[model samples]
Target chain A: MNDQLIALFITFILVAIIVVIGFMSGRDKKVRSSVEEWSVGGRNFGGLLVWFLVGADLYTAYTFLGLTSSAYTSGSLIFFAIPYSILAYFISYFFLPKLWAVAKEYRFTTLADYARGRFDSKLLSALIAIVGVLMLIPYICLQLSGLQDTLQVAGKGYINVQVIVIVSFLLVGLYTFFSGIKGPTYTAIIKDILVWAIMLFMIVSLPMIHFNGWNPMISHITKEAPQLLTIPSSGPKAFPWFITSAIVSALALFMWAHAATGVFTAKSANAIRKNAMFLPLYNIILTLVIFLGFIAYMVLPKGTNPRFALLELIHMSYGGVAQGLAYATIALASLIPCSIMAVGASNLFANNIYRDLINPSVNGARLTMITRCMVFVVIGLALLFGIFFPTALVSLQLLGVAGMVQIFPAIVFSLFWKKQTREATIAGLVVGVIVTFSMYFAGKSFGINEGFWGLVSNIVILLLLNPFFSKRAGTNAIKQFLFQK
Target chain B: MRKVLLIILIALPIISQLIALPFVNSIHPIIVGLPFFHFWLVLWIFLTPLCTWGIYALQKAEGSID
Candidate 1:
């Protein structure tokens, strides 16, 4: 009956009320029978809804929680997120529009479908789907793990971790199961609204109230953690590997199955394109998320979990309704993405795995049902993992990013390279994955992100090996792709 | 068959931890605004795009040269 726990309960109730209303309203039980309807809100979201959904999807709970923790600990190193994300959007703008054009034209539901279209290889498309789905499960695990950490931080011994994780996300899973895309999409509207309000409020309010301004705080950070304020003393994130990893994340951002499904929900490519232009403003909230990290650093015990920095900041700063709202926002930050990721992962399973393999004869409704089932199953596993090996969350997320990036050459290169045979793509994917992972472990042997090293090895091997695997493509397939365009 | 191969493929991360990698070194990066852990994400946001675009440019260069 502690005040914090009571506040959390109130926050949960508010979230529940909103979610139930969303689910009850958005669900079309009769329409849930088809892939187009179930997986994608009937291919019908406008620019605004799609903008918020994809924005929220790309930035998740960990973005706020983990990035802030990075700022708190390392200082300037967290700046890497800005470049990586910006790179993701710009590159996506150029290519994703084409990808979407073809997707809408063909009613393509997965990136695998696009691969199948461009490369004329179902196997390649399916392989991409598999990697996308598997990589995403671990990523979802990180979100749940983050939510677990946040609740533990918020409730502070009043609630059990496992029960909280299970109960909190059960609503997310249920709402998503019934409402499908609209559930996450609707919740995302509220989430983005809150994100804008809180981000702007804290960004201006905190600096004005506390350190007088951002300059003094910047100076304070420099005095405390100068290394964090600038790039590595060795140089601006040196080694070829850093650059390679950055590029890989950018290309890999949209390669995920969720990005594809997220786009499919868009009414047009223009929406995705427009969202790309200003979504960086959401990076505006990012500054506050970073600020919260430093504020936590300034206040909390170092031994305390860095992941709880946002929750602790709210508790320390504002005590009543603000604390409750802040706690809910952090939870929903993870919750919204958790549902979207699970849906994407499960859709991959239902479409690419079950329909493609287990039962080629499966119907759309059946596939949709299987997709919903997989969401709970994935979240269930993440819940178990959250309760157990918590520290692995960061590694799991990095691994997911690394694994997902392996598909970039296979997916993106196919757009321009008509001669890219299935053999070349398969070979490139395999080699790219092996090299990326190999370098990841190699890089992490110390303490840095292995993604950089892994991506370097992956791309080099891919570019070098792809041409040799397919010196020439069959003329018919080339005619099909080129003339089709 | 492809999906099955993917299941095996996803195992790369787990297997990776078993083996040692080369070129590893520590910077002992000092703490900052967020924490030692999360700050790199911001830097990552900025640097990753620049670096990635560099690679894309490299890829473009490689393509044009060929």
Candidate 2:
């Protein structure tokens, strides 16, 4: 058999193993009994499991492929991921433990649940749930595209890539419905291990084998394309953009629904804190991935599509089995996170929107089933959206981060500040979302990040309007959220 | 004193990444063959965790965490 076929065969075998693992993960009948149990593994995971789950959940195929491709095209701009991740953990170190505490006390299953319980406003809860689901769809679509790119490289014109993507997503949707968070949590261990091993091996050995050594690879880039080595001081993605993007992304990291889902799964507040301290270890691998991008730039021929830089490089360099294994790693990277994201989005819809608003009388068992069924709906929407309007999804995916950060005030401020008012938060969210989208569409941000502008307006409105609404501040729920433990 | 220290530990990553960018945003003076820009970011990737660990230690000592 040819190289592509050999690689394809290996990828199929590995993917099959993971699918089986996903199916068998929810063997315990308890995992299927309630929304909480199914959505968060009954919130009993220790630090290690949370670490693996969050690690696998956050670093999707998009990060792997997108970072490398960004490095290939824009040079040092991609390095924003490194610092943002570091800053994210630092921020999470403070807030997530507290948030987890309140979540545990209130039986909060989603961020919307936290908002609803904190502010005593179902309107705010439904708004947050809608925003979470909307932001998450584009992100899920991103993973699909990542999967599509991996298949295209591996199949090499012999196989149908779209059919495989849809089938794989359907399989993921099925297991996610049956196994709930447990499937992704358990399967995440396998995904993280494979990703770390393969990525580390590739980063260390690829340059040495291809360019004789790391020093020589650096020298080649320095001599040929020196600008690839440093962040440009003035331009669209200049130093200002870099700094703002990092800070904005850091602030927005934990606000993503999937990220909160990962946090809510931890057994203890201390588990979240410990995970924060250790999670930066994943950044080490991230830095290496960025380096892989630089390496791809050096090795791949000019005019190659930047999106396929890393995958194409692997295809050219490795044999069939190695290529297949690499492709499978990327594919699983997409699949695992997509499953977690679907769960996160589905939980928001079922818990906050359907149960709280539409039918307050829904039973726990029925709620669990509703959440499970919403998994397919979420994945199906993302798949259809990806197929019909790929470019729109890409642009919206850019807005996803800026858009999700709008919730920062509503969720984070209500945690510590006793004077935080729901009226101000809702006003801020409205202004923030409007400003973020308008700035993005207007094509003018004064070279600063659009999210930064949105957040500024959002905070300004929040602070200015807060004192007027102080009468409703410092409710019993706020006190409970603050000192619950 | 503990609160001040914890605040500083948290701010270390932000300072290194955002505040110190312009000063370190250059390709010259490669360290161990990495551009100083790359080297600085990679250094903080490792060091940021230690900062978090410091905060963790302080919080643990204060009995804020078990």
TM-score of every model versus the real structure? 0.82, 0.98
lDDT per residue for candidate 1 within B2-55, as digits (tens), equals 445434433332122112111221223434434332343444444433433443
User: What's every prediction's RMSD, in angstroms?
Assistant: 9.1, 1.4
Top candidate on DockQ is 2
lDDT of each: 0.67, 0.89
The C-alpha stretches of model 1 lying farther than 4 A from their native spots are A1-6, A235-242, A442-449, A452-472, A475-485, B1-66
* Candidate 2 chain A, poorest ten consecutive residues by summed lDDT: A472-481
Docking class of 2: high
User: Largest lDDT belongs to which candidate?
Assistant: 2
Candidate 2 off by > 4 Å: A481-485, B1-4
True contacts kept of each: 0.04, 0.84
- Candidate 2: tens digits of C-alpha lDDT, residues A1-485: 98889999988898889899999997888888988898888999999999999999999999899889889998888888888888988888878988998899888889999998888889899999999999999999999999999998888788899999999999999999989999999889999999999998898789987899888888888898888888887777787888888888899999998999999999998899889888988998888898899888888899999989999889888968888988999999999999999999999999999987899899888889999999999999999999998868556876899888999999998788878888999999999999998999999898888998999999999999999999856557557648566
Interface RMSD of 1: 9.9
Write the residue-wise lDDT of candidate 1 on A273-318 in tens digits: 6655545445646656766677667767778767666677777777
